[model samples]
Target: MATICISTVLNFRLRKPRGFCCSLSSHDKMKNNNKRETPELLKIAVSGITELLRIFSSSKDQRLDTVTYTQKDQPLVSGIEDIVDILQSDYENAYFLTGNFTSSIYAEDCSFEDPTIKFRGKDLYARNLKLLVPFFDCPSLSLQQIQKVVSSDKSCVLATWKLRTYLKLPWRPLISIEGNTVYDLDDDFKIARHAESWNVSALEAVGQIFTPGT
Candidate 1:
């Protein structure tokens, strides 16, 4: 698991510059946001492992994208260390390519469609995890949920740490070594953070977002 995870993360950099842009947008939101003179409904990118595995295999071992946390900047968060323990212990799952289900990973010309997965060992739930990532300019965002959020909204982007509130979201952390330390928040007034983010960039490099596109 450790070798696989490391190889996977390092492979996100092998893409040609054009590879980073999503098929849905003309360019990354930073560059293309200006060309469109009118407001458009945002088509958000949700994380999925299938694509990350592909991307990592193709990306020649470069460090995967870094996401600055909102909690690193906030002084109010307390008792957060236990958050890591909860995640590492309670969450456990594995990612595998869905045979030939790769064509539908990204939606067709106009929709934000995501793939479908079958997990029955535990109940699954969905929610929106609002993140203050440096790479993004949007105020709110979403992550495809793999757990039940009986107490949270679909609007909140997830963070490893808690902000004003957190839904006790479930996380299936990757197995790893060398560093199990959770990232500390940056100095940028970090408010909230995701308790878990499955690293899936490697899967994307090879166009394995989701073959079936369900």
Candidate 2:
């Protein structure tokens, strides 16, 4: 949840200039250009190292502190059928990406978790979603499938989705994640836990932030 602002390292495949090393003046010009870029490249490298250090030094619980949670009016979900309908409608519009989710269907202390972080409190989750708003460029969440699963002992809603977004970085890195969420309903039929599983490993997902656009 740290708002990372590190620039991705660029790999340039420079083609050899025609008649390279034909003149001493040309070689000197190239050296000057390299010198001019060295500082900028160093800055980028430093920023990237700092960001990673911050991520690793902080505990998962500490990361939640970075998000700002604002209290909002809480409402109740009528029933299981109603919750399903609301979710279907909200997901179609990518409510999560826009921070426009209906907070009523979730308990005040509903737990949320994806590959990166886990925490309790619906307000915190909502605020965290809002944090991504500034950095998101053409974000999309496609709901592949959704269903209510009921069993003798457990009942929940399982929804599969694909999320794609371009982070507003200089490199225009793309974050593409295919995942599913399990919304566990409490006895009162309110969502108590929203757990997600991604197709890629956690490290791979993190790596996506540093990769150039595909």
Candidate 3:
């Protein structure tokens, strides 16, 4: 992100009557005033703006990059190997997640629900992920189990996983949560609905926060 600086200065001097102004000094004062004020005003305005922008830009960058987590080197689970691979690769990369997986793996009218929120449609899901980007850094999801069940015309996958993350908060830097997702797949194997269940509740998550690596 870049910050734009705009500095403007306007100086106006009202003309005085010749009788009120000193005759000997009036001409010299006028000449010197124009020469001095213009450059000084510009310099003052420009420097002030530059310094303010420098401070603002640095602060903004720090806030955006504050949250940092470690990626766990865990192997994928067995059953849904292909989806697990995609999760490890594309979904893990925060930058690529919204663009790649949301459109391909999920149906447009997909319903998603977790402990915190429930929403329908891929656009809302993408928006929720975008909101998380600033607060999530280097987050990793490890797959523990994957089971596939097929009925007459429909199929579903149950995936159990653990998410380990470092939340860049002064009070709680480390957070670990275990959860499972059940995916209802359409005839083409695209995800029609996704739901999640976590071992911890929202208040429990707040209580479980600890220091990183502890």
Best by TM-score: 2
Off by over 4 Å in 2: 1-77
Q: For each predicted model, how many residue pairs clash, with residues at least 3 apart or on different chains? A: 45, 0, 0
Against the unseen true structure, what C-alpha lDDT does each candidate score? 0.21, 0.58, 0.45
Give residue 160's error in model 3 in angstroms: 1.5
lDDT tens readout by residue for model 3, 1-214: 1111112000000111111111222134333332322234443554455445445644656542232223444433333445545444543553221233435666779876433333477765554343344443355666676666666656666655666655444543555666555667776666777765455433344344433334
lDDT for model 1, please.
Answer: 0.21
RMSD of each: 19.0, 17.7, 26.8
Q: Could you tell me every candidate's TM-score relative to the true structure?
A: 0.20, 0.65, 0.52
Residue 114 accuracy (lDDT) in model 1: 18
Give me the displacement of residue 72 in model 2, in angstroms. 12
List model 1 lDDT by residue over 1-214, tens digit each.
2323322222211111212111222123323322322112111111344244435533643323331122222223233343333322222211111011111111122111111221111101110111111111111212222211212222111222111111111222222211011122222312122222222222332232122221
Q: Sort by TM-score, best first: what order?
A: 2, 3, 1
lDDT of 3: 0.45
Query: lDDT for model 2, on a 0 to 1 scale?
Result: 0.58
- Candidate 1, poorest ten consecutive residues by summed lDDT: 121-130
- Tens digit of per-residue lDDT, candidate 2, span 20-126: 11223323433333232224444455445534544543444475456543344454466677678768877997875776777778889997643223458887666
